[model samples]
Target: MSARSLRQVTLLTVVLLLGASLGLALSLRVWPVSCPEAEPYQLGRTGRCVWAAWAADAYVVDGDLEQARERVSALGAQAADTVCSLAVGDCATCRGGQAEAGADLAAALGLACPDGVEGAP
Candidate 1:
């Protein structure tokens, strides 16, 4: 092929690739995504709510800020429950790193983690 034709073909290939990539990204991100009914969470040994973050991205993509916040809050509740259940007696002592988890998860929810709710037995 001529240099001019080769350049045209290369440009066309690049455009096609870009379009396909963009389409795939959008398909994954757009609404109608398969979101979980609940946060399938388990408290890790290190005290992180491992799967509670599953809803945030989908809720955000759906433009439901309230749902996203609620999901995180539910995660926090689950984390606390795990702490309580696993603790031998004083649950207050084992409420571990969840303050940080709350903070990190809160960002995804577009809110800050609320305080003063810890310290249980």
Candidate 2:
């Protein structure tokens, strides 16, 4: 090939290789384990952890969402506790009570979360 064409080909190959290397370095990395789902996991979420592993396993095993819900619902309290512990680790009972009350109030509203709402505005 001509010198000019060879130079262009080499530059193009370098650019493509660099782009691929960066993409591979930034690619999503995840480690699955025993844990509850983090609400709705989607793109841009760190590690992209999706549905609760246990709930997914139950659903896969039973082939029904009813079993999934029944299983995941029972972990609600534990999930809430973990959230609180993460938020106010070693804090007094007042903060914990406030968190509980706020959660209860939100639940009592009986409204689906914004994410659950469908259709256009």
Candidate 3:
């Protein structure tokens, strides 16, 4: 093969590999690939955290401290559990994000978080 043709082929190969890697990374972010057993728990925790945060924020904005506090406490509990089961590395990052979401919920609710929670964001 000509030198230019070989260079073109190499470039194409590199592009394809990069595209594949990017796709894989994006897919992993949206879909849970490992820990099938933990998938349900993760999804439940995520949903609960999100809802709690929204509710707490609304209550806080409305000056309903009591309701906000209740929501925050519930969120903190969910965050603690979700953070605890996450492994190191990328799993840890995902779990940490969940924990942060929970913390945000608690903050909005004006509630003090409990101690000894794993991966407190």
Relative to the true structure, how large is the alpha-carbon lDDT of every model? 0.49, 0.39, 0.50
Evaluate model 3: give its TM-score.
0.36
Per-residue alpha-carbon lDDT of model 3 for 46-112, expressed as tens digits?
2322344445557666888687767656667754333333211113324336454444444444343
Q: What are the per-residue Cα lDDT tens digits for candidate 2 across 4-95?
A: 99999999999999999887766634432322333322212233322442243346356564554455456665433332222222223222
Best by TM-score: 3
User: Candidate 2: minimum summed lDDT over ten consecutive residues — where?
Assistant: 112-121
Using lDDT as the yardstick, the better of models 1 and 2 is: 1
- Per-residue lDDT value at 35 in model 1: 25
Cα misplacement distance, residue 13 of candidate 1 (Å): 0.5
Q: Per the 3 Å backbone cut-off, how many clashing residue pairs does candidate 2 have?
A: 0
List runs of model 3 lying over 4 Å from the truth. Answer: 37-40, 43-121
In model 1, state the lDDT of residue 95: 37
The backbone clash count of each candidate, in order, is 0, 0, 0
Q: Give the TM-score of candidate 2.
A: 0.27
Choose 2 or 3, whichever is better by TM-score: 3
